[model samples]
Target: MVEALNKFQLIGQEQTRRYWETLIGSGRFGHAHILSGHSGVGKDALAFFIAAALNCKADTKKPCGNCISCRQFLNLENQALQLIFALPRRSANQTDPFTGIKEKEMILINEELAKKAAWPYYHLQIDAANDIRIAGIRKLRKDIYLAIDPGTTRVIIILRAHKMNMEAANALLKILEEPPAGTIFLLTTEYADRLPDTIRSRCALHHVPDLNWKLIREDLLQKKGVDPVQAEICARMSMGDLAAAHGYAEQDNTFWLDRIRATLNTLAKEDFVSVHKQVLLLADKEEQTDDSRQQFLSLLILFFRDVALKVKMGETVLWATQSQQMNKLFPNCDSQGAIKAIERTKNALERKVHLQLALTALFFELRKHLRR
Candidate 1:
């Protein structure tokens, strides 16, 4: 191995690794740091690695995974490592005519923490209790001021830090303002913009980049043992999400591809009626998974993107990779219209626009460009 195992379970995040090595190698590191990036980009893994490295007893290179300190950190058994994540007040399915399930909520959070200890990248994707409450923040505040672990540095890592409610954020800001010596606060968030400027400004922020296609390809082939052709397709579609790529490798996207091809047919004929029907189908699908609408929209965008690229760059189509004549099917398509639709739909969906209205407007715009 060219690189010594630095204790981070998550790989491919070069920026975080380089930053940790430099910080620890020079013996100069900050008290607080923010690891910001998209979800599944391994922000949590990076945090655990940094914490372990800081306390490792390796005489030369730090985070020697074999060292006793590194072992404790690896198992997440180190007392100096304080892990905090979002815990909601109740379950998302709690549609009961009552509020407050604090006990149940805490139990679920404990389960999530255990899962995280086993797999640091484990995201408590349970949307219900997804916030770092004021209570957790207060506990952190109390714990930090207490006596330090004699031999190691204290590492407080707050996963999904963006989930902190307003009160919790304020409480955290105070701790970040006047951080104690020998204590490092590692905060990880998928949405840094959700955090207030005051809290953001205090920490040394590092934006972890999305995983590249090359990295995903290597992982798919070597780790998952996926066939080369399918691996290429999965790598293409994952859009820098490791988890999504893994899912694509393991599961068939036949339904997803069929939907994309069906939508492409509507666009090919400039059939406004059919386009509206597709919108209706998507709107209906959203009921099962609230974000299914966006996922479908993402599929559409990819389709349009592939078509546009085929027209412009002569690249093989993703949906019809084997068909050399596929580009001809979209001769009347306005490349500009395709571009506009991708951007407009993406922006509208992100802003939480109503699906029917957004898709209706987009289809009309696309029809106008494609002609009569």
Candidate 2:
């Protein structure tokens, strides 16, 4: 995978390509590079590509996949290449089932859970500044200084460089300022704001944009065997986030739609008790996962948004797919009331209110817009 970077489809960043090519052309491939973008973008993919290009054995522009160096890069067996991933430390109660009881017990007994779990873990937690203790910084410094394997350039890929505390950042800054020979550092971050100015200044930056919806939808259909209609719907909803689109297409969206339908039906029938019960069910189900809550809320928002869009455009309401059946259920709803209800729902979501509370409130509010 690393060897493939030089030739990988970088998707959207043409400018980034020129920047990297210029660096490579100048024999400065050993310099540190930073790839920053929003979550779900292909930053990590590009990092691997860059690493592969650096180590490519091709006699020409280097990452020739056919060369011996390319083979080593492909196998990820090259001693010169080191990949360190900094994942968040799991809560003490959460242990890999495969680990022995002793390991599990050790984690339970460990007293550092609170401190370790305070901040979301990034790709690299090396904080050379105020947040990183001197000991941790010293260890990283030593690791950075270790001699590279003979005849091979060392490449270190840091997955989330933003998680570093001040102490860790300072320690890293020192190395970046006076980088060792034969060393190339690759830092990938989703939240570039959290990174220190000094750290950002030391490395060349590359941006990876979200994948195009058209391409993402096609990929889903071709690679994942998703239905074309479903793929297009998911693609539009995901707004180019391929991972989210895939998840939406793979899951049973019908379940959520059914729940929304039930809620609307209960409200229409003036069954307040049933509406409360339905809200409870949704809240209970969503309590299991943040993803569930997010999906439910998103569906509800889109439902109302589409309804509002229809009313505003003065288009026939039949065009609103999700709300089409609601016409007979609430024949008295006025445009002003519908718009207000939509605005209220949007505000609740923006404020991060509890999903059930938001949904229940929206239901009652919608009653005002419905026929008596």
Each model's TM-score? Answer: 0.75, 0.63
Residue-by-residue lDDT tens digits, candidate 2, 167-231:
66787788788877878888888787688889888888777676776776776677568765566
lDDT of all the models against the reference? 0.71, 0.60
Best by TM-score: 1
Flag clash pairs in model 1: 88-129
True-structure lDDT of candidate 2: 0.60
Top candidate, metric lDDT: 1
Residues 27-49, model 1: lDDT tens digits: 77778888998766778888888
Local error of candidate 2 at 98, Å? 19
